[model samples]
Target: MQKCIFRFIRPQDWFAAINLKDAYVHVSILPHHRPFLWFAFEGRSYQYKVLPFRLSLLPRVFTKVTEAALVPTREQGIGEPPSAALGGGRPSPGFALSRPSLKVLCRPDTKLCFLKSTVNASVLLFLDEGYVKMYLKGRPITMYMPRDLVDTYCLEAKADLPPKKLKLDWVYGYRGRDCRSNLYLLPTGETVYFIASVVVLYNVDEQLQRHYTGHTDDIKCLTVHPDKITIATGQVAGTSSDGKQLAPHVRVWDSVSLNTLHILGTGFFDRALVCLSFSKSVRTNSNVCFCEKKKNRFLFSCVFMPFLSLPSQCSNESVFAADFHPTDANIIVTCGKSHLYFWSLEKGSLVKKQGLFEKQEKPKFVLCVTFSENGDAITGDSSGNILVWGKGSNRISLAIQGAHEASVFALCMLRNGTLVSGGKDRKLISWDENYQKIQAVPELYGPIRTVAEGRGETVLIGTTKNYVLQGSLDGEFIPITQGHTDELWGLTVHPLKHQFLTCGHDKHVCLWDSASHRPIWTKTLEDAAQSAGFHPSGATVAIGTQTGRWLVLDTESKDLVTVHTDGNEQLSVMRFSPDGNFLAIGSHDNYIYIYAVAENGKKYSRVGKCSGHSSFITHLDWSVDSQYLVSNSGDYEILYWIPSVCKQVVSVETTRDIEWATFTCILGFHIFGLWPDGSDGTDINAVCSSNAKKLLITGDDFGKVHLFSFPCSQSRAPCHIYGGHSSHVTNVNFLNDDSQLISTGGKDMSVMQWRVV
Candidate 1:
């Protein structure tokens, strides 16, 4: 140690050093031997699944593993096994490690440093095991090799593929509040939907999802072609983050190939495309009908017909749905706003006739329309009635009264003449040719928005609360996708397990399992939630509301233990001290409320308030010893405080070197390089550091999550960026083990989970 220290005493000498990420975790304890590492912590029994850092045997185990991995390289004259410290005879300016293995190769002109190994079969085996244990729970450290280095060092390179890089594992949430028919049931057993701009096709039985990311703005409506594989989806008009105009448009694509077949209406549609449908009669050249928000204008075009808008008398009435006659290609039926119109194609112009109610009472609206096997028009109305119209009369011939308890929203005719109807009553009902109710499914999670037939007696339903459910006539329904109904903000990770908690503007607090990518439990509060944190013991969680009310709930029982209000404004962030003795609540009123925790986090008492910021408090972190705090505010202020005295540290140098228990303040000196090349102060919304202190992640206003090296000091620091959210990313959190990350979207109402690959 003395010799190594003396070698670096000369100020003129330059040196480089590297620290292995998650070093001790690479060493695993055998299943039977794992029990030997067991201990009691806060009345809970725990055992190490991997070699703990403080274990006495960790050094020898790590060294043996490193040596075994570098044995193959040693034969090629690599200098030596990695040493605890290195001292060079001469001054060295810089060094590079072509290979990550711990074999040290020093020449007169170059010196390679030690780092985590990504080569050799033994190291690969350890990584594979770690992947299983830490999968979807921690951020993974990924490394890449240049092509030339792979060919020179790894002879069997093609046969030995490197470990997969960390990537997005899953995206949560559904977009349904403002759109219609967003969910479609494909014949390939894939339920199709869109969140933000990306189209997602999910298979329920296999628990898999594939995405089609072709649109730039939020998708508004979607329809499946008659052939069942082709799909046409439309989007809203808006400007992207880079000032690019994302015009309203329709994209027709092949679902199996996921390739865009045709992009239509790039500059033609106005505001948004509200409805889309494909003609069934035109087999060779499929015709499409597009409804835009401009005075309910309807455009029709196909291979044989010119793109033209049909003339309408009630231009102010909103058209909810339009369909080509099942047997007549020249006839179109449109229904909306107390009016149903029939139009006939004639000499490049269209003639329309309004369907009259005659002696019957006129319904407020006709929500959806389908056709029977006999080509009779079947329409569902706002009064929960099904009206069968004659093809020739353009009038209602029969009315099935009170088919649903509330307004009917969707209708589908099965191949066997069975009609399925869904509505605001949250019921899915089947009717025979006689319009008699055959079966009624149990009430679902939300009001039904759309319905489509599946195999046999099964049906697929899209609900207002942003869920897709598949069920049989006998009422066994399973949710294929579920998401929040409003904007999401709060995110927190479990202390020990692969679980997390999220709360959002929808007034729902959800606990999710990273392994399954689904919610484990959900508790609803009276107000929307903005911030959340798990106690150190993992027994209780603290949730802060938009109205500044905060509550503590039992993690296991999900029962509210206690509740309190800090201020009238929102609680932006909440964090517990590393030692679990105190909780800090950051509020929009520019105050940090400190509370002393007792009885394992169920009880709390006011400690005091830290008040030094001029703007709203955005984020805060506790010092390692829980005696000091660092906080960021909306106005880009970074201040340190001694929470014990509720006083600010007047001297910045006194707290400059303090090691924080966690790193989350966006304006911290260590995270200065996380900002983009040209960014406003508010571009980044949230920041989190891995528990290992090796990685830092940021969620930004542009719907991006960036991963950077911890304490990124370089200007324009290089990082990995991922995007799935449609709106601003509100919060990001790394799990306790640093194996996974969770991000929430503000307007998209979505949660996404990422795995370190």
Candidate 2:
């Protein structure tokens, strides 16, 4: 066999290679283990099987070579060459090669998850290692893990929590202890709590500490001793020790133990007790003085001079006014209808008596009496005469005549020696030391209810018409302020501050600073404020409203704290206790409510209620000590309630109107002709009363002025009426001395000044 050799050749001519299927092919092999090919394909490997050569068409003879040629060799080796010759063997003319093989690898296992296409679906459950990972649009958002899975993925999320609850607290409460169904509480909480109910607890000690149930009806007046250990009470109308059914009697008791101490009556006389005064004297035989009177008759005086049951003397029927000597503390003085009496303090007997005004021409009756600062006395009569008496025997020092047109109601002494008087004629009159008229002012609209003197030469006047007037001592009438759109019910000046507070039907409290003549502030209440007062320090103000609501406000901040009463009746008046620890509110519900103001000033608690009044309560006043509360009711009675004992000490009926006659007249002609109409007449005047030295002043609606002095220990009347105004007298104010007065009225529509003398 001949060895085959491969060779490569370029195409010599394109036409010569076209049809030559079996033409010579050229192949080249690299230098190592060689094969010849027609093309130069680089870095490629292939495997092929050699086929046996065939000589069908070629005419040749060849030797078979078992080894492939490393390079073409023409000579044969000595012993192994050309040994065997196949019949007609020739090298294969051409060889075929295999094409290059290629293999490819791919990964198709990863996936992305998506929500199903349906409306209104929510996430339910999820599993870890699941094929699907949640995504919005081929972007991964969140992943869920099943409870049993332990996946390592961080979660970036937020959550919202639920809300909390509110809390509240309860304070103290109280129950009634008497038959009157009075309620009281002392709250210690900052916020006020609604009172759910009140129940009275039973006490085995049934004997009341203070008992005043003596009247056939309800007892009217009560007075407790200064020590708060003793109590005295009076009945309206009853039999005396001598079997006189029309006479009123009095009883004294040991308040703490409820023991009867003394019983006194108007012996054989059908008289009623109007007033009482106890002796604070430590000396033997010091008396307890009181006033008594018969119906439509004159007032008389009685003295239980000795605490023992010794014979006590009563003044004659002529006495009209009586009072215990304020300074003496032992001596008692009295005035008859037309006479006066001075009684011995220790003996329970009368010392001296005198008759001043004549009976025939003595106007109608003695109306009032009062004592001067120097122990001198003044008496007023219905004839408008004022009689002044010195300290000596029964001798008259001065006489003021024609002071008022009607009976005198009030009298007061000024800083100077002059006196002021107010009467039913609705006029105010001023008088000098000699009892001579100095100045007169007519009060228009309504009667003057009260007068107050202020510092720095100012005087304040309160009128029934619901207005307050201020003026200088030099007779300059300045209208200060007005309230209650309806009537001037009550007025009280701030005890320390130059400001004054007024309340009325307007349901508002107004404060006026006198120095600037400007209204400082005004507070409107939910109901009509009948009365208002400032705390002794003036830092807090207390107002009583008609809805039985009491409000205490911080004057500076105007923040209010309200104390609500059980009933919705009108609270007529209110007063702060002397020590400022308690507040007393009187209401038409016939109950006096006491509230204990907490020390921290955050809350108020009801202590107790004093309920003895049978009718609507109209007014109330507290003693310097808060232990005693005095109240006046529409029943024409005054009662003293002692808080410590939770009882009434003394009940006294001062006067009772003829209800039948007054009612019939009001019903019959109240709406009739102009002359008898209830409207105050054109000629009507204004009047005011004062406890200052027993002075009364009247200013007519027409501007007439009058002055009178009603002695606390003598009988006297209004002197005369002084005419001055062209129209009605609206208001009247008294200066230091009754010698100077101020008046305001209509027509002129301006305040007017007058000199009494």
Candidate 3:
């Protein structure tokens, strides 16, 4: 059916009449605008006018409708509240309108900061200026800057931020007022960070004051007293002082108090005190002095009676060598250039003197003199001959001639009465009791400076050419195995087996098998190797390398098992304990390292380190029982160590310029010690045994061998000198039957066999 609907619409400020005929009419209105409607009537016309809200609309506006009836617009206002007529329109029954409100809409961009590709930033330090900027994957994060970086960042970060940006995810500030100079960054926890700074200041003057300002020279020799309260210094000429220097002075002072104790200087010509030594028995209160005479060019040793006023007497113009008897505190022996003399401290007179072989073309200058294992006198001379005089009247018992072609630099007597000698002419000789040369090996490319024998036939020879030779007693001189690339200063043979060790300028410890003539192993020491030897058992080898690194190596494996000590200025010698448990390493740094070796399944480990020597360790040896270890260094003192107590047992000063020293069992109760005497000039070497036997041996720089003997057993006695070699004698060895002796040296490079004829 056809429908008619009446609707009231508010347009601006007036009401409207609308009719719906066949279809419903849709109408819409807005604030302050006219109303709009659409109807489906065939023909219809409506008029609307703007009026005030109080005005009412007239009806019958749809009279022209054709197919539908019409309804007046005023009828639709019936449901309106009274307020509808006011300016505020309330509500209609069909729809309600609320107050108008404001709402805002926004869209934000998500761009992040970027980092510069060319400039990479590192966290040097954290400081107070600004946060440290770090870019991760083109995102920036800030870290607290270190104090040192604050000043630097202030100057560097002044430019505008780079086009590439960084994303900042975190930041932290510096704390405290003090600024650090150096910075280190570390992780605080799992994800946090921390910074550490270190400050430094330089002081140049203090370092210079400590090393340069000294009394005189390079301070070659220094000796400290038993209490360590006093220090004695020996100054050589041409050092810190003038070259024409003579009679070098000895100064004593309190080490801690720095107070001067005493000064000893000579009035007789400006003669340098070449060597000095203190007594091992602290109660003795006396020191020995060895001086070189300039006129006749001789060596003399004086007891230096400090408490007594009587002037010391010169034994003889021929006196060239002397030393205190190791066991006796008052007795001393001197070997003259032509004769040997014995002196008694208690008697204050020359006990007995013996004249050497007078048959030589000229008075044979006694090159070296020493005591044998039985307290008998032994001597070598310029004629390349070795003489031994014991209890047998005034006649010489043993003589070895033609020991070496050049002057004999060193001589060592083994426990089995075998004499080992080296000389200037690059020759090594082994001798027998009758002074017969048993084996003459000429493997050294330079002058043989030293020779040592191990337990068996192994012999160790050191040369001036920075190399060492290990050979057998069968006249087979093994070629040098190149390990130390510098001049070899010293060498020592193992007390037990065919193994021997050496040290040189290269600062390396090298182990060699004399039988194989090959280097079994080598170790690089911080300092140069001066001397080394194997322990009594041949298991551990002690090495005295430069820089004071006294080390012990396992002979079988050549492993650096232990560093006995360090911080030495120079190390000179090393020796092992007879029992093969302890090692002694000596350094030019004026200290010795005594260490114990622990074995674990063929590996040796250093378990202890000891220090005792006060200068470079020049010589070293161990007792047969291994209870005592002896060492000599630049301080011109011999030190004895007792490993059981881990302390120094005894220290003796052998006042002679000890080039080398060793211990050997000769007689039933006698152990002999041998060393070089006289400076680099004459080949006056000496040998002595604990039994007090003395001998005189002379040699020239060209390798000569001489032999002589003394009668006294308890005192340092003199012996008769005998001439043999045309040149210096380097080595001496006793025969198997003890009747003949063998000698070798430089001039002819041949080992000579001698007898007691």
Candidate 4:
């Protein structure tokens, strides 16, 4: 059938088709072949009558016989060659007929479009390529698929191939909100965590990161195998880029090689895979116990083979976390809203028993669970209490009340047997074997979501605000990984250093070390930041806010030196003159506010405002001499301006002779080729030229970054395109040396550092 589709049909071709109803009954099998279909059932012998269902040779045989009969119609030019029994149900053959009367052959309610067996001709009927790919793949093309096939089939693709010559050095975000078991300290000194559709393996000691670009949507849960080398991560269901529904599933891979070993539950799980765990015992085969969002949707499956399931009578609680017993693979514990279940496998059947609170009141939710060295189940509840349940009794044997100031979110047992608990109160506390408080570290930045032990006494904490902190038992916890919580667009590179600053709608302005992919300092602002720029001396940086308020800060001390406002709107672009004499602040109010720089950018005075643009200013680049500027606006207007005179230059010939300091203008003559065909002139959001002026990189609305030769003057310009950001690539910038590139995601709230190879 596929061969027939390829031989006769093209995606662009259309026609009317006829489906021969009960077409298989039209052909009669020979007596000798009919005996082959004989069957005996319930002590009764049944002889073959018609073609049987699910016969492997039926489609081929029926298609051959039906095509022979339809050849006469094709010879008479009445129709094209017919395709018989495409669906194979009852030999409902289809023919593409050119006759106008045959157009109504397919009813409106029919799933398949009817086509006449005639010459390939145009018609009003349409078929989407996404559906064609879905039909070819023989399944729904949802959120999670291989990266290469995503763009062609997915409805919402969040993962794509990294750019050639551009390696994704790090992802500056952590998925911690309402997720658990997501942070792990692997044996190789790599910290495993996930953000968006990518799993990041960051090594704190080396300041390096490796990415596992597997999942296609938002990751919800992660777990490590007993070997500490194998890892499994799960993602929530999402639509593909073309709107195909993707199922929630888990992926197991080697942490060192970063090779996927297995993908579990593509079509089996629903809603989301909340949590998963690896059984400690692997003598026979590794087993994984996982739970999902729906009621009683739990499965105990082997990593390589068949699966066991819990009875349907199980509780309908939303499972939050699951763990296998340290010594017994059959013993599993799952915790969720107001319920703690102790599940065990016996005689190839699964059974569960509820853990009793005894004299203690039941907590609202059991947020996390872990196994102790002595085969005890330690569970943390929403009431800021920790309960220890005996393996035999399934009842709370020890209770530690007020272990934290707020609801306990995570509990971890270190190698030295020192138990640590983190909670919504922004505190990390340590307890001794007797459950007595040892020490408490308070004043954390955000609510702790998950906790894992690092080297020695240090513990890694995953926070709800997308932060991963590393701290010792007696020291302060410093954030090792941080990301914006809202849309981000502001991005600027240091003039002379391998450093950059980013700001976003989350109100955070962060100075980052581009080489290490780590934040050096972060300051929260009252209003969301929209644009940023650094002075040529790299001593002071200006951060523009959404409300037309801009602040210039001393780069060294991060001290605010000045604050000024133009109209009440967002500042879309901020650029400083290469000579360090002027600063341009382009606002959404359709004005560019120019300021004179003095005292090495410590002081600024209003020079003049460039106002001829009819729409909000989107981008601008100053000439090297600082006399002329080119700007783009939201209304697709590209205009040249003279900042000193605050006048728009209308002569194209005059502007063509000017040498610009930057080539970021999207609509300029030298770079007109940047716009693809059918584009409305706003597809490219940001453009940056390399320091050497040899390369131009662009960030577009579809989360793609393309690097083209400088002065791309040809339409449909050839370029090296890359994808990593799951949202719009709001901004792109290169380091002063042009050895590194940075791109910011708008809605994914991530900063991706790319190394130029």
lDDT of each: 0.72, 0.42, 0.39, 0.72
**Model 3: how far is 444 from its true place, Å?**
5.6
lDDT of 2 by residue, 1-757 (tens): 0122112212321110111112111111222222321121123222222311221222221111111221222222111111111221223344343212111000011111111211111111122322112111112212222222223221111111112111111111111010110111111111110111101111112311111222331132343343434555544463221233544566666534546677766453244554455554444333465555544222223233222342345544544445555467545566545556665545653455554544435545665566677777776777777777776436677777777776665565666755767555656676664545433335532454334444345444444443444554457554433333433343444555555556556565666554443557767667776656556566777777777677777776667855566468877666666667777777788887877765533367788888887887655555554666655565434466665444786422211110110010100111011111111222223333322434445444433444444211011122344433323444444433333344433332223334444
Best candidate, TM-score: 1
| Model 1 spans > 4 angstroms off | 1-166, 281-284, 303-314, 438-444
Better TM-score candidate (1, 2): 1
Model 4: residues with Cα > 4 Å off, grouped in runs: 1-164, 238-247, 269-271, 293-296, 306-318, 346-359, 392-394, 434-444, 475-478, 516-518, 612-614, 666-683
Of 3 and 4, which scores higher on TM-score?
4
Please identify which of the two predictions, 1 or 3, would achieve the higher TM-score against the true structure: 1
Rate residue 282 of model 2 by lDDT. 42
TM-score of each: 0.75, 0.28, 0.29, 0.73
Give the root-mean-square deviation of each candidate in angstroms.
Answer: 17.2, 46.6, 40.9, 16.3
Worst ten in a row by lDDT for model 4 = 133-142
Error of 2 at 175 (Å): 49
Instruction: Name the 10 consecutive residues with the lowest summed lDDT in model 2.
Output: 661-670
Candidate 3 on 380-483: residue-level lDDT in tens? Answer: 65666666656433457766666667565556666676666666666566666465554554543456544545335666554544334556766566543233
